[model samples]
Structure formats: structure tokens, C-alpha cells
Target: MNNKKPALRIGIIGGGISGVALALGLCRHSHLQVQLFESAPAFGEVGAGVSFGPNAVCAIAGLGLGETYLHVADRTPEPWEDVWFEWRRGSDASYLGATITPGVGQSSVHRADFLDALAAQLPEGITQFGKRATQVDQQSDELKVLFDDGTEYPCDLLIGADGIKSALRNHVLEGQGLAPQAPRFSGTCAYRGMVDSLHLREAFRVHGIDEHLVDVPQMYLGLDGHILTFPVRNGRIINVVAFISDRSQPEPTWPADAPWVREVSQREMLDAFAGWGDAARAVLECIPTPTIWALHDLVELPGYVHGRVVLIGDAAHAMLPHQGAGAGQGLEDAYFLARLLGDTRTDAGNLAELLEAYDNLRRPRACRVQRTSLETGELYELRDPIVGANEQLLGEVLATRFDWLWNHDLDADLTEARARLGWEPRSRGALRQG
Candidate 1:
């Protein structure tokens, strides 16, 4: 008689990059049953672009996607320059200062293309479309992911990566005697667009500005806000992200209100930056239609795990995008979780220890990134009185601000964690197919 135990059944909420990556990584075991629920009718993304740093590339590489990811990613224009960032005054385009990233470089890609690449890596029949989870209920032996379709999926573990408006996140918070909370606004709004490279080059030529600005992305700084520009798609396009402290709206944002935060006309954005210099105007003028998003992030959760379920990515710790680490942090989460869950020694009966290990390693690091991202924006907008004191200090501060973030090695971290947690390493070939 066969006396072996059943394989772990893992259910993931959200089919975004993080969720799919986690599922794909875990599926390499072939013993773990991984299913993902995506509320969208099909897998896709609606955003303009994302900035991927070396750490992000390494994290994706851990999933065996480093080369595949490079196909869609463009090496940002910082490799040739000694300094990585050129901070400039938005009024006259006068260079305030610049910061150098000694080793770190970034790759930018369209959000849809990245998402498609991740989805393409996932196998068919694993993701159930239009399945929006309403609530997660944990019983004695199994966890139930209740959906809006009056159906429930039973799983041994749940990973919620459903993003900023996640529905399953409530269960994790509520289990800890905490009231369900939504992401809070940071009194900031962003207008985002992508400008064609040829278009930006012509705009710079017409403005009679140094052509170097297009070669290396520039950050035009001003009072209460900043504009960040970078190249994507092998310098064929420029992604423009503008941040402003918007006080035009009321508190506790309600999306039902017409002309809410998600949508803003190009004229409104132009009006907001009316006094900016030519560079800002040049990029702004190229954006035929601007998409606006009210930046909101989660407060630190008391814990990321509850019983058989856990949270990852934005559902656990969404943050401001000032440092461009929001999605990258999510990727990091998937990397750790996949390795922990896929370990041959890990079994469904001992999932609590696995989850505890995840919380111990991932929570602290992700929260630090969240807080750092917030403070970074403050510096960019000259809100931090100290960083705003002088441009030289600002340049120095920005230069080294992200070194620790980019230099982290997940493999080393995993080794340390195993030692710290008394986990025994197993041979990679030992993973049995269920």
C-alpha cells in the first residue's frame, strides 16, 4: 500500500507578474498544485511602464527568466554616464546637481509587455479568469477561497498578490483582530505617459536644449513635485512620470465621484505644471492623453501570515513608486516564497514553519522598502527639509540611497534564513512529482 502524503495545493490570488512568477517557480517542482485567480477577463496590465533595477533583474533571473525578461527590457541610458541621475530645476532647466549609481543600472519596459511575458511563462489551465475572491475562510484542515461566482476553491495555502484593491487582503487583516483597511493616500497624484524617442528628440531639438537629456533620463525637480523621464524599448520610447502634491480633492477618496483620481484630462495636468521649464513642457506636450492615479499605500500590517494563508506583493506592503521598487519588491517576495515552498523537505503539515520563515525574512525587508520609497519621494519633492537644504547634499544622498536595496542577494539570504531557522537544505533533484 502507498503511504505517501498528498502534495501541497497552493492557490494564488491575482495573476499579475508577482503571482504568475510565484506559480511558475513553484510549478518547477511538478509536485505542487498551483492555481491562480485573476479577476480580469484575461491576463493583462493597464499601466504605461515599470522601472526594473539590477536587483529586480536578479530576482526574475532566480525564476529562470533573466534572458527572457531581457527581450522586453531596455537597458536604461545610465551605463555611459558617470552619474546616473541628473537633477535639474524645472523653471530654467539649469542643472541643480546629479547622482551616480556606481554599479546599479535600470531597465524599463511597458507594463503590458512585461505582464504578457510573465503570463506566457505560465501554463494553461492553471489560471481561472474572472474569479474575484470575495473572502477567505479557513477551516480545520483546508482554506476556502470564496469567489463572487458563488464558488470556493480549496487549497492548502493561499498567497494574496491581488494588488492595491485586493479583496482577499481583508481576511489576513481581520484574522489578527484588526479592522479591514484600504490603502491610504499620500496626498500625491501622478500623471503618467510614454513619449516616442523620435518625438522626444525632435522636441529637444525644437526647444534648443542639450541633446544629452534624451540620452540619459532626467529628473526635473520643482516645488511640491518632480518629473522623472527614462528610455524604454531600446530607447525607442521615453516614459514620463510626474508627481504632484494634489490638494484639489477631498480626503478618503471615493472613486464613484466623476473626474476622480484615476482619470484626468491632459489640460488639467498641463495647468498643474504651467510654470515649469521647457523640458517638463516638452515631455508634457507630447503626451496626447494623460492617465492620472492617486498614489495610495498600505500601513504596515501587524503580520503577513494567518493560519494557512499569507500575503505577498502589494497586498501585503504596497508602497509609493518614487524608488521604482514597488513591483520589484513583489518580485522579491515571489522569489523567497517559491524557494521556501518548493523545498523538498517542506510539506503541507509543516507549512506553519515555512510561513513563519517567510514572515521573518520578507516582512521587515519589504516594509523598509515601503518607508524608504515614501521618504525618497519626499526628498524628490524637496519636502524633506534636510535633503532640500542644498542640491549637492541631495545629489550625494540620492547617489547612495539605493545601494543596499540593489545589492541584496536572495540566495545568500535564503542560506542565512535556513541556518537561522534550523531548516535543512535538500538536493534540488530530490523534488518528487506528485
Candidate 2:
């Protein structure tokens, strides 16, 4: 007689960093069947560069992508290896402070390059492109993911990594009798562009600005606006994002039909930062064409798990990029969720308890990061009432604001999750052996 259990059918929606990382992590197990559905024809990341903090680095390593990430990740040069960002006043270029996080300062990568690195490791026949999930239907034994191509995929579980504008989000919320929420416009518009590092350095020299600004990651803070620059492509190019806020309205609002991103003239960008210090202008001058992005974040959902359907990454908690921890949070989600689902004790029979454990452990932390990221953006624009323009106070807060976020221990959470699901404690080495 031959008696063997069937593999768990797991379907992941979306193909960005979070979805791909989760897929790679789950694929390590032999008893789990995983498939990823992406809307685009091929895997790609929109945006210039993304930075990860120490906590994110830990999560990446936990997911077994440490070596892969390090191969493409960029860090601040020596002598400033521990500096996250040198903060300065945008008006006069005076130093305000710096965020010093040791060992993993400003570890960033070109979004597309990092995505490519992760996607390259996915097992063949595991991803289906051009599959955009339009709706999710729950049956007695499985969940059905209906794609825009007039096709449906049935799986034991569904994971929504579909980003801020998630279709599965409504399904999850509606199942729980909660009203579906829309993505909230943060009332901030960011102009993004990339510039050649050498050209920016020469501009600094001609403009008599500090050339070190080009080599190291920097944040120029001002009233109602800020500019951020960091190296990508192994220091050959610099990624720039300049932000402008409109606070006239008491509450955040944006038109539902308006395009989120649009092209704008360089002159418009220059005029936005007019009267700023030479350092800020020099970086902006390098980009002849720039795109303006209407920054939007999801309204916090009441929960991330409902039945066999769950959410991850921006689908659950999309936040502003002020803390540079948004992507890191997604990575953390992938790490925790993958570990739970890949645990030896997890099976189709007890999926509810295991997924609930995941929701209990991850929801609080990701939501907190979401809230802090928005606050950090306000602080960068000098809108924080407590630390407003107080250089000493701002410096003190900047030095340690990220300690709780970056110094988190994901292994401990895994242990707690195991206990929650009545599973025996297993050492990291033994868990990997499974």
C-alpha cells in the first residue's frame, strides 16, 4: 500500500520583491506547491532605488537571500560605513544631524536589479505572468483566484502581495463584514529621478558644494519639503527623490481618477526647490527629465487574515518612504509568513490556526511601521511640533528613532508563533533541516 499526503497548494498574487521573496522561501520545502501570479508580462520594479535597514537585512538573511542581496546591495563607503544619512538644512546646507546605524547603513539597490536577483532564483514553472487577480472566491475546501484573463486558479491558500491598490484586499475585508478602504493620498508629491554620480560630483565642485554629499547618502530637510539622494548601480549613479507637501487641507485627499505618476519638466522641479541651498539644486540639475509621484498609502485594515486568504507587503501595510523601512517591512512579512507556512507542523488541516498566528504576530509590527513612516515624513519636513527646527532635539531623536524598528528579532517572533500554534520549539538549525 502507498500512503502519501498531497502537497499544500499555495498561490501568491503579485510579483514584486515581497511576493518573489516569499515564493523563494516557501519553495525550499519539498511538501509545499507554490505558484506566483504577476500582472506584468515580466518581473520588474517601478521606482529608482530602495534602501533597507538593519532589521530588513536580518529578514533578508533569514529568508536565505543574504548572499544574493549582498552581491547587488550598495552601502556607504568606508569611513562612513555606519552612517545612514547625513541630515542637513536645505536652506543653508548647515548640518542638522546624522542617523548612525552600524553594520548595515544605507544598504540599497536598484529596484530592478534586486528584483532580477530574486526572480532568477525562483524554480522554473513556478510563476505565471500576465495573471492579474481581479477577485477571490472562497469555496468549501479551497480559494479561487479569478484573473483578468478570464481564468481562475484554485489553491489551498491565497496570499495577496498585490501592493497598495490591491483587489484581494476588498475580498478579505468583505468576508469579515468590514468596509473596504481605499488607498489614502498622503498629500505629498515626490519628484523622482536618477543622475550620474560623477556628473553630480563635478557639479558639486563647480558649485563649491561639498563633494562628499554625492558619495554618501544625504537628506536635505526644509519647511514643507525635503530632498534625498543615495548611490545605486555600485556607486556609478545617484538616485534622487524630492518631496513637496500641500498641507492646506485639514485631511489628506486626492482625486480617485487622477493619475498617480506623471512626467514633469525639469524647470518645474527646479522651481519647486527654488531658494534652496546649492547642494540640493546641484543634485536636481543633473536630471533633465523627472517624474512626479503622488504618494499614497493604504488605510490600516482591521486584519490581514480571513479564512485561507491573507495579505502581505504593501497589500497589508503600505507606508511612506521616510524611514526607508517600507520595503524592509515587506521583507519581514515574507520572512515570517514563509517560516510559518514552511514549518513541518503546518498542513492543510490546521491552516487556520497557523495563519491566525501569523496575523497576530505580524499585524501589530507592520502597522506600527506604517504609522511611524508617515510621522517620519512629517519630521523631515519640519512639521513635527515637538522637534520643529530644534537642531539639538532633532539630532537626538534622529540618532535613535530607528533603534526599535531596525533592531527587531524575527527569530523570537517565529518561536512565539510556534508556541501559539501548539508546536514544539525547534532550533534554527533543526528547522532548516526540515
Best by lDDT: 2
Question: At residue 318, what lDDT does model 1 achieve?
Answer: 94
Candidate 2: the clashing residue pairs are none
Candidate 2, superposed: residue stretches over 4 Å from native:
425-434
What lDDT score belongs to each candidate, Candidate 1 first?
A: 0.81, 0.90
Candidate 2 residues 283-317, lDDT tens each? 99999999999999987678998899999999999
Task: For candidate 1, write residues 1-434 as lDDT tens digits.
Answer: 99766888999999888898888889878568889999989988767778776778789999878877888886645455344567888887788766555544556688888888878878878889999999888988768899999999999999998997788778887887889978787788889988898988899899998878887868998878899888877888888988888546556463645342566678999998999999888888998888887788988877898898899999999999988898999999999888877877778767887788788778888888899898888888887868774777877787778878877767766775565446756445432110
What RMSD, rounded to one decimal, does every model reach?
4.5, 3.2
After aligning candidate 1 to the native by TM-score, how far in Å is the CA of 128 from where it should be?
0.9
**Model 1 clashing residue pairs (backbone):** none
